[model samples]
Target: MKKILLVCSAGMSTSMLVKKMQETAVKEGKDYEIEALALSEAESKIDDVNVILLGPQVRFQKPQVEKVAGGRVPVDVIDMQQYGMMDGESVLKHAESLME
Candidate 1:
């Protein structure tokens, strides 16, 4: 299964998105592992993740995340509008693209 790592400020709000994405993935019959963690926990989780997604609230940390994630993982910030509106399908598509 592909591994997706999500990072946010407190790791609370993004947990909701994580659930949505997981539901979307399941509905689409995609086999993957998705998890959400606080930005502070990213370093420890990076090694196990195939992709890193950032919540808008933590967009500023993209560079840092990229640095620590090295070149092995794809890292990008979730669209603020999409996230605020909780558009899971779009986010799931974004995550899927990273796998390619």
Candidate 2:
């Protein structure tokens, strides 16, 4: 299964988003291993994921994460509107596009 990592300040809110994204993926018959983590833990976990999505609150950390990713994994921020709405499908679509 492909892996998607979502990171935020403390990983709490992103956990809810992860559950929603997983539900959407299953409904679409796609099997993906999605997870949420605190930015502090993201660096240790970055190498294992295909893409990294930063929560709007933590979007400023993008360059740091990208540095750790070393061009191997795509890094982006979840759209502020979509993230505020917890729109999993849209975020998943964005992640899918990045993975492709």
The numbered model that scores best in TM-score is 2
| Tens-digit lDDT track of model 1 for 8-58 | 988899889989999999999999888989999889989898999999988
Model 1 has how many clashing residue pairs? 0
Error of 1 at 20 (Å): 0.7
User: What are the lDDT scores of the predictions, listed in order?
Assistant: 0.91, 0.95
With a 3 Å backbone cut-off (N, CA, C), the pairs that clash in candidate 2 are none
RMSD, every candidate, angstroms: 0.7, 0.5
Q: Lowest-scoring 10 consecutive residues by lDDT in candidate 2?
A: 40-49
Candidate 1 C-alpha error for residue 6, in Å = 0.9
Q: Give the TM-score of candidate 1.
A: 0.96
* Candidate 2 global lDDT: 0.95
| Most lDDT-accurate candidate | 2
